[model samples]
Target: MSEPSRIAALVVAAGRGARAGAGDPKQYRLVGGESVLGRVLALLGAHEAIDRILVVTHPDDGDFYARTTTALAPAAREKLLAPVQGAATRQGSVAAGLARLADGAAPEIVLVHDAARPFLTPDLVSRAIAAAQAHGAAIPGISVVDTIKRVDETGRVVETPPRATLRAVQTPQAFRFAPLAEAHRTAVAAGRDDFTDDGALMEWAGHPVVVFAGEAGNVKLTHPQDFAATGGPETRMITRLATGFDVHAFTVGDHVWLGGVRIPHTRGVLAHSDGDVVLHALTDALLGALAEGDIGTHFPPSDPQWKSASSDRFLAFAAERVRARGGIIDLLDATILAEAPKVGPHREAMREAIARAADIPVSRVSIKATTTEKLGFTGRGEGIAAQAAATIRLPEEDA
Candidate 1:
């Protein structure tokens, strides 16, 4: 009745992240200056449509989270609901998160996510939510890129699973709250502690889940090297800094594009056509000090045809606009913040991408990351947050 109260989100960060081999839990490690949990929360908090947010973390880590994650929006904080006790396993953590939901206010749908996945994108979350609403459950995942192997006790390959049928699942896993709550409760009642993620438990209970394509960049930071591998610091620049930040929320759409690459994500940027916030922010910063309008006025996210155009093209168009305006693009600095795909190792790649796309030297671009310190909307890792700034030189005035 009453449309089941729409949807809600539950983020599970309770894992100690021991496998990352860090002095502290990997979640506490600093990436681009902010902690992992902080980054995750930022993405979740940014989503405007989500009805509520529940963060389930370890009891020991609660105080730290409480102190560090103060950047969250007042409205989001009001809807905030967790940090409850998680079980020894991930499934346990979900149960704990569910238990923390308000007694009678359970959402019609729930999204379960992993805190280790700093690269989680808002588009991915939105897509999963859409799917969950259509079907009973939905998940974001990508087909395996590497060879698959089923190993034996001796650590030898016992069988090779076909790559075509296999998929590496990511979060946030979405499901109808009542069914998910029932599944978790049933699992716990049966002492079925082996479930690794919410999807598995749902499948076991006869729910057919729909899978959507996931971004190649969306990665889980399980090992210490993943941070570096995904676009963390080692590749970061130390001087002549320019920062750009831009955020565009969901409007009606079949999919959204980010980072110049097409992802099967949900909803296009709300601004002008090809709402490429990343490129727009970069362009504005490139010309920001010069007082130029952002990508919106130049490209106008409102135009109908730019409707499904590629954002990379917009960046290129911006580059041409800058050159025609007699400005020589210098160092381009940008950062993409979301709770989805890893961006650190990819920073260099992104630099290369921007450089090649703009026909500028690769050395001139710098891409770095930062979480919200787990304090604001970014802290919840809701919408994708990006900041960029460009250094440029304009022609001398004709006397």
Candidate 2:
């Protein structure tokens, strides 16, 4: 069988969504428990025909976007490209996306979509792909149910146009990549960002654009009430919990590192790295929660670059790994077993240090200290040990 045509989806999410003023951009607002843009990107990225997913976002929205993407599934996360900054105008943003694609390996077909329209179905996506292949350029549109009018500047009635001749347009607007890119480039050169949509831009460029079936349920969420009607979508989520334990023997030194802070002690710990026992245990716990290998698996003892490296780096790396996989680290709890250095003196410091490394609030971190009562390695003043647990949430399908 011949290979299917390669397709890419360009999501325009730079709009401030001022009309739907609940707070933040409407795209970043939660529809269900997930951000509107997150839902849109997830649906598009999960589609088989969409080989690549590029998003155009406002430059200031980077942090918001990062937080939102943690709700996606792994499959969708894998198809996403690094998002690019969008321009002031929606037309300018589309131009930016086209330009970005043109600089690299472009796809045969590209679909332009609005981030506010979060209920896009896989069937609509598939139909759009087929329509673009058949018609070179096509937009999904539904017939206008109400009578339309051509209005004058005054409130008086002007002309009633036939409803049959008018259609309400929606997005996932598909087109042949090369021609659409050319039209967008021409529009940019003429400094004409007045065209509201790509269809109008194509029409201006003399390209024949066709209309495909559009769903009424795929309504563009504009006003605040529109959000009220949407309690939330049925996006599934699952929580994961994992535990880790680590031990390190003491050697000759003046101090030791525990959690992410250095505490004055009678001796140092022996390891390839700085040997922060508490941090190593917490790092392992986070990786274990994601079913990813332990800290040694990532920063091998054999690797020369990691020699005497700070354990905080390992914890930060593990936390970022969870974020990249579309997961949220709910909490990190650690218990330190040491006899010599009293942990009570620096408990809050350790919590603050660990929280900084994990990019979470200090409230999410708990550090408890206990001694073995002169029994084992930790109690005999021979070494220090720690145990940690990590709780996280990920898309249920991925879990």
lDDT of 1 at 300: 66
Residue-level error in angstroms, candidate 2, position 385: 28
How far in Å is the alpha carbon of 103 misplaced in model 1?
1.6
Q: Residue by residue across 1-399, what tens digits does model 1's lDDT show? A: 444446788888888988887576777666553467766776676676687777887878866687546544334455566567777888888888887774666788888888778777778888888889899888888888799889989999999988999888888888989888888889888879899988889998888988887777778888879877754434332222244568866656655455554444544456555656666677667545445566567666567777757667767776666555444566777777665445654566566667656656566777777776676665664466688877765433300
Write down the TM-score of every candidate.
0.59, 0.60
Give the alpha-carbon lDDT of every model: 0.70, 0.87
Global Cα lDDT for candidate 1: 0.70
* Residue-wise C-alpha lDDT for candidate 2, range 106-203, written one tens digit per residue: 88999999999998899999999999999999999999988877887886779998888788999999999999999988987988988879999999
